[model samples]
Target: MIAVSLLEEYGGIIKNYKSGDFIFEEGNRPLHYYQIISGEVKMNNYNDEGKEFIQGIFYKNQCFGEPPLFIDQMYPANAVAVIDSEIIIITKDKFLDLLKNNSEISLKIIKNLSQRLYYKSVMAAEISSQDPEHRVLRLIDYSIEQLNFKKEEAGFLINFTRQQIGDLTGLRVETVIRAIKSLEKKGDLKIINRKVYR
Candidate 1:
Protein backbone atom coordinates (compact mmCIF):
# COMPACT_ATOMS: atom_id res chain seq x y z
CA MET A 1 0.00 0.00 0.00
CA ILE A 2 1.09 3.58 -0.60
CA ALA A 3 2.30 5.41 2.49
CA VAL A 4 -0.25 7.67 4.17
CA SER A 5 1.91 10.76 3.70
CA LEU A 6 2.24 9.97 -0.01
CA LEU A 7 -1.50 9.38 -0.38
CA GLU A 8 -2.15 12.70 1.34
CA GLU A 9 0.29 14.41 -1.00
CA TYR A 10 -1.71 12.93 -3.91
CA GLY A 11 -4.94 14.47 -2.52
CA GLY A 12 -6.23 11.50 -0.57
CA ILE A 13 -8.97 12.31 1.92
CA ILE A 14 -10.03 10.27 4.93
CA LYS A 15 -13.63 9.14 5.16
CA ASN A 16 -15.37 7.35 7.99
CA TYR A 17 -17.97 4.60 7.55
CA LYS A 18 -20.26 2.95 10.08
CA SER A 19 -20.59 -0.77 10.34
CA GLY A 20 -22.74 -2.24 7.55
CA ASP A 21 -22.22 0.79 5.34
CA PHE A 22 -21.65 0.15 1.66
CA ILE A 23 -18.42 1.70 0.44
CA PHE A 24 -19.37 0.85 -3.13
CA GLU A 25 -22.11 -1.18 -4.74
CA GLU A 26 -21.79 -3.87 -7.33
CA GLY A 27 -21.70 -2.61 -10.94
CA ASN A 28 -20.78 0.91 -9.88
CA ARG A 29 -18.07 2.66 -11.84
CA PRO A 30 -14.78 2.99 -10.00
CA LEU A 31 -14.26 6.61 -9.02
CA HIS A 32 -11.66 6.46 -6.27
CA TYR A 33 -8.82 4.40 -4.91
CA TYR A 34 -9.64 3.22 -1.36
CA GLN A 35 -7.15 2.24 1.30
CA ILE A 36 -8.18 1.22 4.79
CA ILE A 37 -6.92 3.19 7.77
CA SER A 38 -8.72 1.12 10.39
CA GLY A 39 -11.25 -1.67 11.00
CA GLU A 40 -12.43 -4.21 8.42
CA VAL A 41 -14.19 -4.27 5.06
CA LYS A 42 -15.46 -7.16 3.03
CA MET A 43 -16.18 -7.48 -0.68
CA ASN A 44 -19.10 -9.79 -1.40
CA ASN A 45 -21.91 -10.70 -3.72
CA TYR A 46 -25.28 -12.19 -2.86
CA ASN A 47 -27.05 -14.80 -4.93
CA ASP A 48 -30.75 -14.89 -5.86
CA GLU A 49 -31.43 -16.49 -2.47
CA GLY A 50 -29.51 -13.70 -0.78
CA LYS A 51 -26.70 -15.95 0.30
CA GLU A 52 -23.50 -13.94 0.53
CA PHE A 53 -20.26 -15.22 -0.87
CA ILE A 54 -17.42 -13.15 0.50
CA GLN A 55 -14.82 -12.35 -2.15
CA GLY A 56 -12.27 -11.01 0.30
CA ILE A 57 -11.71 -9.33 3.65
CA PHE A 58 -9.34 -6.39 4.04
CA TYR A 59 -7.86 -4.78 7.12
CA LYS A 60 -5.93 -1.67 8.12
CA ASN A 61 -3.25 -0.57 5.61
CA GLN A 62 -4.80 -2.83 2.96
CA CYS A 63 -6.25 -1.45 -0.25
CA PHE A 64 -9.39 -2.75 -1.94
CA GLY A 65 -11.27 -2.46 -5.24
CA GLU A 66 -8.28 -1.47 -7.36
CA PRO A 67 -8.72 -4.06 -10.11
CA PRO A 68 -11.80 -2.31 -11.49
CA LEU A 69 -10.04 1.05 -11.43
CA PHE A 70 -7.13 -0.35 -13.40
CA ILE A 71 -9.34 -2.03 -16.01
CA ASP A 72 -11.95 0.76 -16.24
CA GLN A 73 -14.65 -1.75 -15.32
CA MET A 74 -17.56 -1.68 -12.91
CA TYR A 75 -17.09 -3.22 -9.50
CA PRO A 76 -17.99 -6.90 -9.54
CA ALA A 77 -18.94 -7.03 -5.86
CA ASN A 78 -20.16 -4.69 -3.15
CA ALA A 79 -17.72 -3.45 -0.51
CA VAL A 80 -19.23 -3.18 2.97
CA ALA A 81 -17.72 -2.00 6.20
CA VAL A 82 -17.62 -4.89 8.63
CA ILE A 83 -17.08 -2.45 11.44
CA ASP A 84 -16.83 1.31 11.91
CA SER A 85 -13.91 2.17 9.68
CA GLU A 86 -11.72 4.98 8.43
CA ILE A 87 -10.51 4.89 4.84
CA ILE A 88 -8.42 7.14 2.65
CA ILE A 89 -9.87 7.89 -0.77
CA ILE A 90 -8.00 9.35 -3.70
CA THR A 91 -9.70 10.48 -6.89
CA LYS A 92 -9.11 8.05 -9.72
CA ASP A 93 -7.22 10.61 -11.80
CA LYS A 94 -5.04 11.66 -8.90
CA PHE A 95 -4.35 8.05 -8.02
CA LEU A 96 -3.24 7.40 -11.55
CA ASP A 97 -0.98 10.43 -11.38
CA LEU A 98 0.55 9.18 -8.16
CA LEU A 99 1.28 5.82 -9.73
CA LYS A 100 2.81 7.48 -12.77
CA ASN A 101 5.05 9.58 -10.55
CA ASN A 102 6.15 6.71 -8.28
CA SER A 103 7.58 3.56 -9.74
CA GLU A 104 8.27 1.83 -6.39
CA ILE A 105 4.66 2.14 -5.26
CA SER A 106 3.46 1.01 -8.71
CA LEU A 107 5.55 -2.16 -8.40
CA LYS A 108 4.09 -2.76 -4.95
CA ILE A 109 0.61 -2.41 -6.33
CA ILE A 110 1.36 -4.97 -9.03
CA LYS A 111 2.71 -7.36 -6.44
CA ASN A 112 -0.37 -6.90 -4.25
CA LEU A 113 -2.68 -7.58 -7.21
CA SER A 114 -0.72 -10.69 -8.09
CA GLN A 115 -1.15 -12.02 -4.57
CA ARG A 116 -4.88 -11.50 -4.77
CA LEU A 117 -5.05 -13.32 -8.10
CA TYR A 118 -3.08 -16.20 -6.64
CA TYR A 119 -5.44 -16.44 -3.68
CA LYS A 120 -8.49 -16.50 -5.96
CA SER A 121 -6.98 -19.23 -8.12
CA VAL A 122 -6.09 -21.38 -5.14
CA MET A 123 -9.46 -20.94 -3.43
CA ALA A 124 -11.36 -21.58 -6.66
CA ALA A 125 -9.71 -24.94 -7.04
CA GLU A 126 -10.17 -25.78 -3.34
CA ILE A 127 -13.85 -24.90 -3.37
CA SER A 128 -14.49 -26.80 -6.58
CA SER A 129 -12.91 -30.15 -5.78
CA GLN A 130 -11.79 -30.30 -2.17
CA ASP A 131 -13.70 -31.57 0.83
CA PRO A 132 -14.85 -29.18 3.52
CA GLU A 133 -12.00 -30.07 5.85
CA HIS A 134 -9.39 -29.60 3.15
CA ARG A 135 -10.89 -26.30 2.02
CA VAL A 136 -11.00 -24.98 5.57
CA LEU A 137 -7.42 -26.00 6.30
CA ARG A 138 -6.16 -24.46 3.08
CA LEU A 139 -7.84 -21.17 3.91
CA ILE A 140 -6.42 -21.14 7.46
CA ASP A 141 -2.93 -21.91 6.23
CA TYR A 142 -3.16 -19.33 3.50
CA SER A 143 -4.39 -16.68 5.91
CA ILE A 144 -1.62 -17.45 8.35
CA GLU A 145 1.02 -17.14 5.66
CA GLN A 146 -0.43 -14.27 3.63
CA LEU A 147 -2.76 -12.33 5.91
CA ASN A 148 -0.42 -12.24 8.91
CA PHE A 149 -2.66 -13.79 11.49
CA LYS A 150 -1.19 -13.28 14.94
CA LYS A 151 0.63 -16.09 16.66
CA GLU A 152 -0.07 -17.04 20.27
CA GLU A 153 1.63 -19.36 22.69
CA ALA A 154 -0.66 -22.20 21.63
CA GLY A 155 -0.38 -21.63 17.89
CA PHE A 156 -1.31 -19.17 15.17
CA LEU A 157 -4.71 -17.74 16.07
CA ILE A 158 -7.30 -17.83 13.30
CA ASN A 159 -9.07 -14.50 13.18
CA PHE A 160 -11.97 -15.63 10.98
CA THR A 161 -15.21 -16.67 12.59
CA ARG A 162 -16.88 -19.95 11.64
CA GLN A 163 -19.47 -18.06 9.62
CA GLN A 164 -16.79 -16.11 7.82
CA ILE A 165 -14.91 -19.28 7.12
CA GLY A 166 -18.04 -20.82 5.57
CA ASP A 167 -18.67 -17.73 3.49
CA LEU A 168 -15.10 -17.74 2.20
CA THR A 169 -14.91 -21.50 1.60
CA GLY A 170 -18.44 -22.03 0.24
CA LEU A 171 -19.47 -24.27 3.14
CA ARG A 172 -22.36 -24.01 5.57
CA VAL A 173 -21.75 -22.64 9.06
CA GLU A 174 -22.64 -26.03 10.50
CA THR A 175 -20.22 -27.65 8.12
CA VAL A 176 -17.50 -25.27 9.21
CA ILE A 177 -18.18 -26.01 12.87
CA ARG A 178 -18.10 -29.73 12.25
CA ALA A 179 -14.97 -29.48 10.16
CA ILE A 180 -13.18 -27.50 12.83
CA LYS A 181 -14.15 -30.01 15.47
CA SER A 182 -12.92 -32.80 13.22
CA LEU A 183 -9.71 -30.99 12.57
CA GLU A 184 -9.19 -30.56 16.30
CA LYS A 185 -9.75 -34.24 16.85
CA LYS A 186 -7.20 -35.07 14.21
CA GLY A 187 -4.62 -32.81 15.89
CA ASP A 188 -4.61 -30.45 12.90
CA LEU A 189 -6.18 -27.57 14.85
CA LYS A 190 -6.96 -26.44 18.38
CA ILE A 191 -9.83 -24.60 19.96
CA ILE A 192 -8.85 -22.65 23.03
CA ASN A 193 -11.62 -20.67 24.65
CA ARG A 194 -13.63 -20.98 21.44
CA LYS A 195 -10.95 -19.35 19.34
CA VAL A 196 -9.44 -21.50 16.62
CA TYR A 197 -5.69 -22.05 16.49
CA ARG A 198 -3.48 -23.82 13.99
Candidate 2:
Protein backbone atom coordinates (compact mmCIF):
# COMPACT_ATOMS: atom_id res chain seq x y z
CA MET A 1 0.00 0.00 0.00
CA ILE A 2 1.10 3.59 -0.62
CA ALA A 3 2.10 5.66 2.41
CA VAL A 4 -0.59 7.96 3.80
CA SER A 5 1.52 11.07 3.25
CA LEU A 6 2.19 10.04 -0.33
CA LEU A 7 -1.47 9.28 -0.93
CA GLU A 8 -2.37 12.70 0.43
CA GLU A 9 0.17 14.28 -1.88
CA TYR A 10 -1.58 12.53 -4.78
CA GLY A 11 -4.95 14.06 -3.81
CA GLY A 12 -6.29 11.21 -1.74
CA ILE A 13 -9.27 12.14 0.44
CA ILE A 14 -10.51 10.33 3.51
CA LYS A 15 -14.13 9.17 3.50
CA ASN A 16 -16.08 7.64 6.34
CA TYR A 17 -18.57 4.81 5.86
CA LYS A 18 -21.03 3.33 8.27
CA SER A 19 -21.38 -0.39 8.81
CA GLY A 20 -23.33 -2.08 5.97
CA ASP A 21 -22.68 0.81 3.60
CA PHE A 22 -21.85 -0.01 0.05
CA ILE A 23 -18.58 1.58 -1.00
CA PHE A 24 -19.26 0.52 -4.58
CA GLU A 25 -21.84 -1.71 -6.19
CA GLU A 26 -21.36 -4.50 -8.65
CA GLY A 27 -21.25 -3.32 -12.28
CA ASN A 28 -20.22 0.18 -11.26
CA ARG A 29 -17.32 1.71 -13.12
CA PRO A 30 -14.14 2.00 -11.12
CA LEU A 31 -13.30 5.66 -10.63
CA HIS A 32 -11.22 5.68 -7.47
CA TYR A 33 -8.46 3.78 -5.79
CA TYR A 34 -9.54 2.84 -2.25
CA GLN A 35 -7.33 1.88 0.67
CA ILE A 36 -8.62 1.24 4.16
CA ILE A 37 -7.51 3.51 7.01
CA SER A 38 -9.45 1.68 9.68
CA GLY A 39 -12.04 -1.06 10.15
CA GLU A 40 -13.00 -3.95 7.91
CA VAL A 41 -14.50 -4.23 4.43
CA LYS A 42 -15.72 -7.16 2.36
CA MET A 43 -16.20 -7.74 -1.33
CA ASN A 44 -19.10 -10.09 -1.88
CA ASN A 45 -22.06 -11.16 -3.98
CA TYR A 46 -25.39 -12.72 -3.22
CA ASN A 47 -26.84 -15.52 -5.31
CA ASP A 48 -30.43 -15.79 -6.47
CA GLU A 49 -31.32 -17.50 -3.19
CA GLY A 50 -29.78 -14.60 -1.26
CA LYS A 51 -26.83 -16.68 -0.08
CA GLU A 52 -23.82 -14.45 0.46
CA PHE A 53 -20.44 -15.58 -0.77
CA ILE A 54 -17.60 -13.39 0.38
CA GLN A 55 -14.88 -12.84 -2.18
CA GLY A 56 -12.43 -11.29 0.22
CA ILE A 57 -12.14 -9.44 3.51
CA PHE A 58 -9.76 -6.55 3.85
CA TYR A 59 -8.50 -4.86 6.98
CA LYS A 60 -6.69 -1.62 7.74
CA ASN A 61 -3.89 -0.55 5.34
CA GLN A 62 -5.08 -2.98 2.65
CA CYS A 63 -6.45 -2.03 -0.75
CA PHE A 64 -9.60 -3.48 -2.27
CA GLY A 65 -11.34 -3.41 -5.65
CA GLU A 66 -8.24 -2.44 -7.57
CA PRO A 67 -8.25 -5.09 -10.32
CA PRO A 68 -11.22 -3.43 -12.03
CA LEU A 69 -9.52 -0.04 -11.94
CA PHE A 70 -6.43 -1.41 -13.57
CA ILE A 71 -8.37 -3.18 -16.32
CA ASP A 72 -10.95 -0.42 -16.90
CA GLN A 73 -13.76 -2.86 -16.12
CA MET A 74 -16.88 -2.68 -13.99
CA TYR A 75 -16.67 -3.99 -10.46
CA PRO A 76 -17.48 -7.72 -10.36
CA ALA A 77 -18.64 -7.68 -6.73
CA ASN A 78 -19.94 -5.11 -4.28
CA ALA A 79 -17.58 -3.55 -1.77
CA VAL A 80 -19.29 -3.11 1.59
CA ALA A 81 -18.13 -1.76 4.90
CA VAL A 82 -18.24 -4.50 7.52
CA ILE A 83 -17.97 -1.85 10.26
CA ASP A 84 -17.81 1.92 10.52
CA SER A 85 -14.63 2.73 8.64
CA GLU A 86 -12.39 5.45 7.29
CA ILE A 87 -10.94 4.97 3.82
CA ILE A 88 -8.56 7.08 1.79
CA ILE A 89 -9.47 7.31 -1.88
CA ILE A 90 -7.87 8.98 -4.84
CA THR A 91 -9.23 9.49 -8.32
CA LYS A 92 -8.22 6.67 -10.60
CA ASP A 93 -6.41 9.05 -12.96
CA LYS A 94 -4.40 10.52 -10.11
CA PHE A 95 -3.66 7.05 -8.78
CA LEU A 96 -2.30 6.00 -12.14
CA ASP A 97 -0.19 9.13 -12.20
CA LEU A 98 1.21 8.34 -8.80
CA LEU A 99 2.14 4.87 -9.99
CA LYS A 100 3.71 6.22 -13.13
CA ASN A 101 6.00 8.46 -11.16
CA ASN A 102 6.85 5.93 -8.47
CA SER A 103 8.47 2.71 -9.57
CA GLU A 104 8.80 1.21 -6.09
CA ILE A 105 5.13 1.79 -5.32
CA SER A 106 4.14 0.34 -8.67
CA LEU A 107 6.19 -2.77 -7.97
CA LYS A 108 4.53 -3.13 -4.59
CA ILE A 109 1.10 -2.91 -6.20
CA ILE A 110 2.03 -5.64 -8.68
CA LYS A 111 3.24 -7.83 -5.84
CA ASN A 112 0.05 -7.26 -3.88
CA LEU A 113 -2.10 -8.15 -6.86
CA SER A 114 -0.07 -11.27 -7.49
CA GLN A 115 -0.57 -12.43 -3.93
CA ARG A 116 -4.32 -11.99 -4.23
CA LEU A 117 -4.40 -13.96 -7.48
CA TYR A 118 -2.48 -16.75 -5.82
CA TYR A 119 -4.89 -16.83 -2.86
CA LYS A 120 -7.87 -16.94 -5.15
CA SER A 121 -6.37 -19.79 -7.13
CA VAL A 122 -5.68 -21.82 -4.02
CA MET A 123 -9.09 -21.15 -2.47
CA ALA A 124 -10.91 -22.00 -5.66
CA ALA A 125 -9.31 -25.42 -5.69
CA GLU A 126 -9.92 -25.97 -2.00
CA ILE A 127 -13.56 -25.01 -2.16
CA SER A 128 -14.17 -27.30 -5.10
CA SER A 129 -12.44 -30.44 -3.92
CA GLN A 130 -11.58 -30.23 -0.22
CA ASP A 131 -13.62 -31.38 2.74
CA PRO A 132 -14.99 -28.86 5.23
CA GLU A 133 -12.16 -29.37 7.72
CA HIS A 134 -9.53 -29.07 5.03
CA ARG A 135 -11.13 -25.92 3.59
CA VAL A 136 -11.37 -24.30 7.01
CA LEU A 137 -7.80 -25.21 7.92
CA ARG A 138 -6.49 -23.91 4.62
CA LEU A 139 -8.14 -20.55 5.18
CA ILE A 140 -6.87 -20.28 8.75
CA ASP A 141 -3.34 -21.16 7.70
CA TYR A 142 -3.46 -18.62 4.89
CA SER A 143 -4.73 -15.89 7.21
CA ILE A 144 -2.04 -16.58 9.75
CA GLU A 145 0.68 -16.40 7.11
CA GLN A 146 -0.70 -13.65 4.85
CA LEU A 147 -3.30 -11.63 6.77
CA ASN A 148 -1.30 -11.25 10.00
CA PHE A 149 -3.78 -12.63 12.50
CA LYS A 150 -2.98 -11.75 16.11
CA LYS A 151 -0.82 -14.03 18.22
CA GLU A 152 -1.87 -15.09 21.73
CA GLU A 153 -0.32 -17.22 24.45
CA ALA A 154 -2.42 -20.16 23.35
CA GLY A 155 -1.66 -19.84 19.64
CA PHE A 156 -2.38 -17.62 16.64
CA LEU A 157 -5.90 -16.34 17.17
CA ILE A 158 -8.18 -16.62 14.17
CA ASN A 159 -10.03 -13.36 13.72
CA PHE A 160 -12.75 -14.69 11.41
CA THR A 161 -16.08 -15.66 12.87
CA ARG A 162 -17.63 -19.05 12.09
CA GLN A 163 -20.13 -17.34 9.80
CA GLN A 164 -17.34 -15.50 8.01
CA ILE A 165 -15.38 -18.69 7.67
CA GLY A 166 -18.42 -20.41 6.18
CA ASP A 167 -18.94 -17.58 3.73
CA LEU A 168 -15.30 -17.55 2.68
CA THR A 169 -15.00 -21.31 2.35
CA GLY A 170 -18.44 -21.97 0.83
CA LEU A 171 -19.65 -23.99 3.78
CA ARG A 172 -22.74 -23.61 5.94
CA VAL A 173 -22.38 -22.03 9.37
CA GLU A 174 -23.39 -25.29 11.04
CA THR A 175 -20.83 -27.12 8.93
CA VAL A 176 -18.13 -24.68 9.95
CA ILE A 177 -19.02 -25.13 13.61
CA ARG A 178 -18.89 -28.89 13.28
CA ALA A 179 -15.63 -28.78 11.35
CA ILE A 180 -13.99 -26.59 13.95
CA LYS A 181 -15.14 -28.92 16.72
CA SER A 182 -13.85 -31.91 14.84
CA LEU A 183 -10.52 -30.23 14.22
CA GLU A 184 -10.25 -29.40 17.90
CA LYS A 185 -10.85 -33.03 18.77
CA LYS A 186 -8.14 -34.05 16.35
CA GLY A 187 -5.67 -31.65 17.96
CA ASP A 188 -5.43 -29.61 14.77
CA LEU A 189 -7.04 -26.53 16.31
CA LYS A 190 -7.97 -25.14 19.70
CA ILE A 191 -11.05 -23.29 20.86
CA ILE A 192 -10.27 -21.13 23.88
CA ASN A 193 -13.22 -19.11 25.12
CA ARG A 194 -14.99 -19.69 21.79
CA LYS A 195 -12.14 -18.19 19.80
CA VAL A 196 -10.33 -20.49 17.39
CA TYR A 197 -6.58 -20.81 17.72
CA ARG A 198 -4.05 -22.57 15.49
lDDT, each prediction: 0.97, 0.97
Worst 10 residues of 2 by lDDT: 1-10
What are the models' TM-scores? 0.99, 0.99
lDDT of 2 by residue, 7-95 (tens): 99999999999999999999999999999999999999999999999999999999999999889999999999999999999999999
Q: State the lDDT of candidate 1 residue by residue for 32-69, as single tens digits.
A: 99999999999999999999999999999999999999
> Residue pairs in steric clash, candidate 1?
none
TM-score of 1: 0.99
Going through the candidates in the order shown, the clash numbers are: 0, 0
Error in Å for residue 43 of model 1: 0.2
